[model samples]
Target: MDIKELQAERTGIFRDVYSNKIPKRVPVNLSLTLEFTAGFGNLNMAEAQWNLSLLEDAADKLCQTFYSDSCPFGGSMRYPSYYQTLQSQSFIMGSNGFIQHPEVVGMDVEDYDYLIEKPFDCIVERIIPRQY
Candidate 1:
């Protein structure tokens, strides 16, 4: 089939699901992480994160390979170096080319009562600075 035909077919599958009707087969939507996409395309994850077009190409390749009905690309790509420069220690890029979330105890055991009392204040003053 041509590109238009392929798109129409994919759209029909989504329409079926949206209209609460079962189509001939279920549509497969693939959610790809940057690390997985980079590995699939044989590209460096750190470099791919900086180059969104390269990341998009990787995502396109994955969608075609997996015959995915829909795959949103570049949604999870983050600039770790930029964040790191900003002194944001929440997310770290490991040597394995994967983004790692380090565990941080934002709230102490005694701080629970304060957090419960002032949820917004706790998030803005306590959590935001620590995490981001």
Candidate 2:
């Protein structure tokens, strides 16, 4: 079948599931990680993260190879531009190019009163600044 026909059949499977109807078979939605894609495409994980199009291409190739019902490209990996724009300090890229989230205690143990009194402020002024 053509790409369009394949895509249509894939969509129909998902639509059936969402609409609470029995599909011809169970739709397999694959959750892919950047490491897997990078390895699959023989790409450096850092380069793949920076070059989102490369990741997209790899994901498409993977879906086609595996005959996946659906594979959400970049669903598990955020664009590097987003982190750059936000000046994010929370997420760290490892030497091997894997993204890591370090544990952070954003609030003091005694900060419960502040959280109760001003939840939005706690999130915006206190928690976010401390965490990110």
Candidate 3:
């Protein structure tokens, strides 16, 4: 089959599954993070994430390693630059290139009354700034 026929077949398989019908066969789908996928290509996760061109090798490796029905080549869900620019206190990049969310106490006990009185205002004005 050509590319369009293959795409249509894949779409039909998913559509059948969603519509409560058995597909032609089980769709061998998988979910993987860019950090994890980078390993298959022997890539530095951090460097590959920032230097987008490096992802071609990873995509090639992913196809070779898995028989998934489909996979997306896209940016990491947690972008390092956004976190760095925002001075994010909650989300930080780990040594492994994965984003980590640490426990944060954005508001003090004394601010409970303020939070109760103006929840949205308090969160937007004080808590988000502290955490992000």
Cα lDDT, model 2, residue 47? 83
Best by TM-score: 3
Q: Give the clashing residue pairs of candidate 3, or none.
A: none
Per-prediction TM-score to the true structure, in the order listed: 0.79, 0.80, 0.84
Query: Can you write out model 3's per-residue Cα lDDT over 1-132, one digit (the tens) per residue?
Result: 997998899999999999999999998777777777677778887887677678787887777777677774434688788898999988888888777898888999877999999999999998898987
Cα-lDDT of candidate 1: 0.76
lDDT of 3: 0.82
Give stretches of model 2 more than 4 Å off.
1-5, 72-75
The 10-residue segment of model 2 with minimum total lDDT is 72-81
Best by lDDT: 3
User: Cα deviation in Å at residue 51, candidate 3?
Assistant: 1.2
Residue 25 in model 3: lDDT: 98
Error of 1 at 125 (Å): 1.9
Score residue 49 of candidate 3 by CA lDDT. 69
In candidate 1 the C-alpha lDDT for residue 32 amounts to: 67
Q: Model 1, residue 67: what's the lDDT?
A: 58
> How many clashes in each candidate?
0, 0, 0
